[model samples]
Target: MTGSLQGETVLVVGRGSGIARAIVGAAAAEGAQVVAAGRNREALESAYKGTSVSVKGVDLTDEASIAALADDVGSVHHVVSTASARARGALGELSPEAILLSFHTKVVGPIMLAKHFAPEMPRTGSLVFFSGVAALEPDPGFLGVAATNGSVNVVIRSLAVELAPLRVNAISPGTVDTGAWDGLGEKKGAFLEKLSAANPARRLGTPEDIAQAVVFAMTNTFMTGVSLAVDGGQPLV
Candidate 1:
């Protein structure tokens, strides 16, 4: 181990999902203290099952909760957010509540996190945000996800400049066979199968694939203000 972050602490937001869980796992493996925040206690435990990870249930959308989480974690060296809320539909097609649902968590959540935590992050600390291929290439069926993902992509670069000295980067992952498929319900298996067939790697990405990239973005001192695509050549389409 390079001990890059041997004594440093990284706070991972949205620890419930498999990708987020894997990120926490990887960060812990690399010698950094891991702190996970999310509303799901069981999922957070599962993520840090055997690691020395501190878990907290934080509602990222709530101001009080966000502030409290930052205070509890205190003096974080890195922040990785995998907090994506599942909501989809065209702009006018979805109800106001439904549209706000995904936007608040996925789009606004990271912004708020940065606002609250950036002040606490060291000058060289890093922040990695998750985006999807949908952000790079838009599709009609996923209007909401695509819109928010794309917006956040731009936000990463813009904020990287504004945040300065500290790093801000986005990780756009390809079809990862994480629980994200279960969200598709009835078509879960078929959707993953089709996605696997489309990938140049002949397989969909795993949580580990994206997690490694997340760790790189977080620990790589000289990198900042860029979005790294960890899609395994899928975006070639």
Candidate 2:
């Protein structure tokens, strides 16, 4: 609304849908030059077709890929990483590979991003990452998810201090209707309904809701090294 991002470049790393797409839209609406990058470059190109958005390829698990992306994009005003590998299972069901993938994708990957991109960013530039309510509201089946998110929370603080003036923060989302639960099949609706009623906000979160918070994190000059919770109060109850 403020068009504060006009003429600025924003690079968002994630799949071309869900919260990532919403963020691209939000930033673009604020007059930013948005680049959407993920493993599926063709899909992203198609997704943003006819728009001002550009598309690129990236794999969070690969540090080289991240570095190359940083080179390709050059200087940017802000960067948002929404990529995550979900390892949803109980202790017995969780595998070492799955856990490693989760950490590699969410934790180590972003670190690599900062390593390569920070040099190209202005002092006013910022980085936004995705943490989750799982870190705060630990549950049985989401152990891996929680651990990865918890690491992100700590990383945000460390990076904020280390990167100083280059703002680093995260957005922790509660239960959202992002089709992440569609794998639940018929049970998905009921699952969301239960969470909606339980959440203090009395509704499931939307990509746009999280996007609005991200805009704040990117534009707010003084805020850094913090994880913003945009989960509609799901962790409280």
Clash pairs, candidate 1, are none
Model 1 over residues 23-129: C-alpha lDDT tens digits? Answer: 87788788899888898878788766776888888886787888888888788999888888766756667677776878888778888889999998899898888
Residue pairs whose backbone atoms clash in candidate 2: none
The TM-score of predicted model 1 comes to 0.92
The 0-to-1 C-alpha lDDT of every candidate, in the order given, reads: 0.83, 0.93
lDDT of 2 by residue, 1-237 (tens): 789799899999998889999999999999899999999999998899999898999998998999899988899999899999999999999999999999999999999999999988999999999999999998999999999999999999999999998999999999888878888899998888999999999998999999999999999999999999998888898
- How far is 35's C-alpha from truth in model 1 (Å)? 0.3
Clashes of each: 0, 0
Off by over 4 Å in 2: none
Angstrom error at residue 203, model 1: 1.1
